[model samples]
Target: MAKRKGKGPTPKAEDRHWHGKRQKARAAKNAKRTGTPTMGPSGRPTATDSPRPSGRPAGARRAAGDSPELVTGRNPVVEALRAGVPGTALYVMSGTDERIRESIQMAADRRIPLLETGKNELDRLTDGAVHQGIALQVRPYRYAHPDDLLKGTAPLIVALDGITDPRNLGAIVRSAAAFGATGVVVPERRAAGVTAGAWKTSAGTLASVPVAQATNLTRQLKAYQQAGCFVAGLDARGSTPVADLEVASGPFVLVVGSEGKGLGRLVADTCDMLVTIPMPGKAESLNAGVAAGIALYEISRLRS
Candidate 1:
């Protein structure tokens, strides 16, 4: 077979400029002191001082959109391993903490290959993230289509609106799993995608729970309503208590949004009903994750 060609998309100029500015300044200063021109041997300006690629690995920040994502930092890596996020390889160095060794052992047990990389190379690979001498490369997540999650008898779906945090997405997925929901749906744009942080937060529940993306959240919720599912939007000002939402016994979809701003106006209008979680204490609002969890639990309880 002929050798492969084409390196891929051209990196931005900033990413290409890995050379230290101090070195270039020093070179210019020397040239000025000697009364000589500062140029490469070939007489081209900036030719001798050309920026070199970091040679960052595939999962690095430089290639984020590319398949696979690198889980950097020691605690995150260990959590990923413990959560059983499917990994392709473990890039690590020596003299790390006990957590690193534990992660290595986990990788070995799972038959995931360990490639010993140096500090500089690992830094380049992670795009300057604190890797703590260890990182795990996980396969790209395959998202389910919004309609694909509509299957199953009396399917229950959870739709998220403007929830940008991956950890919140993971928590919602976990609750969806616990409450026997069909799947979780998130807006395709301006929403969090499955990442290392989500994997760690889900504690591996994400492996079984599928997350679907919707191009338009309100439209998708309308579709769900047309399909005969009762759509409920969780908001602080809602008049209906989540516990009394007897609609959970049948086809249902619960929409959640950010805590600060609550649900978007369009999404709120799309829902068939609006439900609120009652809190008698001094607390004001719940986090997206916690709110989703409480709502899902109540819905589950009502269904049971």
Candidate 2:
């Protein structure tokens, strides 16, 4: 069958409004979700219609000072909650296993906002890291000044020099708490801060043991020296054996260096005395955490 065209030539295909009415609806929804104004002063399109990669609200991408720390994984979340880590919200993936039930209960008991999200959304929030179906948004850790750590009549303090591993820091914090040490001092830069991993590794002792940050560790050690605290640097090669150290029972600052590199030159030179842990085994050295733990235990024993 032949049909005659009525208009001039065939009506050209016009560009359709791809966004159309749906785009406006989506923009309004997003504006409400993000707490943004839906329209501009002149009634222009002010709201964002584009979808976020992680499906999170636009308000989530706030300033660094306002952004929440994301602590993922079931065990970490549970431990952070148990340790009373300040939290803003607890997110659980829909259909998550029973492993996270305790975390849920803890969050509920603490009155933390509990949110259920899809697996993909959860993955986006954790930056594709293995979250194990749960994540906790916690506040940043507040660090004390080096002098503040020494204010109390604490006989022992542990200072970390270039120890970049958060787990090691956490272990050291835990060891210090167990040994009745006053606090831990870490460098303000080029060092591990009290992060979520550290919090988890501390096994809930972070709350009790204060962590202080020093702008200059060498200077801080010197200050400690002036305050009548002996500065003992832990190195493989030292003139004094940790066990036979005469100052073990006195107020002391035990400085532990990084595993790869020992203490910095200035830090090494600032020590009142260098001490070595006597190793009878064939192994060259112990892990930084293990070494710190051993030194702390010895100091505690001698003090006791």
Candidate 3:
């Protein structure tokens, strides 16, 4: 074979790749130098990357470790502390609350770090997420077993067959707390985890209710049923109407499925009875949160 010396000039495809990268770099540099915004790959200037005045005044972004960010207000931060969020840090506005006096005392006793800041400073740190004037910097949420939550009283458990929306989960938690439900059960996978958005959407109700995540939802339902709880699945096609269902004044569980697709067949089969909410309007179905709220409130009313 004839000897081929060194490789020739780079192929056109290779040249184009390097050229594209160089062009991107040059564009970014020009934008930085001229103080002109550059379009992103989607042909839009990134709102976050664009230079803008700090939302807070000077000294607002306090140096890290100067103090943990303040969690303020009455219910949220106090409930967070009471719920045993690990490593909670608290800051209260001086003389802002007399209602939280007991909560403040508890914080002092627990040796949770405490400081006082202006309401504006508290507002800056919380980004307006209902600090209730008390803010806590703590670890993420911790979930427990549904039965564990029901240890003392007959549990009113909300079992989600396939709820994947963080907002819906939050809303359900809020409703569960309002209706005095003991816990919320969700599947381990194909579902939304307890994230900040869910916590926030719960409007601080997450602190009030225990949440359980199950590896097998059907098996968990069976466990609840065996534990003397009535397992009811919410299905539009169910033979029973939620209003008409003869609910015993005992421990019960209600299951709500995912949006778009209804309950998984296995989960539906696990329920002792499937209940439906009657809708006479043009809408064929309800949002997961709304449906969950109705069922929870009805159960609460019946139990009471």
CA lDDT of each candidate?
0.81, 0.78, 0.70
Residue 196 CA error for candidate 1 (Å)?
Answer: 0.9
- Where's the lowest-lDDT run of ten residues in candidate 3? 57-66
Candidate 1 lDDT, 51-161, residue by residue in tens: 211324322221234345787777878878899888878888874589999999999999987877788877766767777888787877888998888887788899999
Q: Pick the candidate with the highest TM-score.
A: 1
Model 3: lDDT equals: 0.70
Clash totals, every prediction: 0, 0, 11
How do all models score by TM-score? 0.78, 0.74, 0.57
- Residue-level lDDT tens digits of model 3 in 1-304: 8987998787885467688888879988887556476666987554333322222222111112223333345765566456454435556666447646756777888896665656776665665545565555554456787667565456788889778777799899999999988889898778876654466678778877888988899998899888888888899868888776556357888899875787999988889998988888999889999999998878877787
Error of 3 at 285 (Å): 1.0
Error of 1 at 281 (Å): 1.1
Candidate 1 Cα outliers beyond 4 Å, as residue runs = 1-63
Residues 135-168 of candidate 2 have per-residue lDDT tens digits of: 7876667888787777546468899999988889
lDDT of 3 at 240: 85
Off by over 4 Å in 2: 1-66, 79-86, 118-124, 152-154
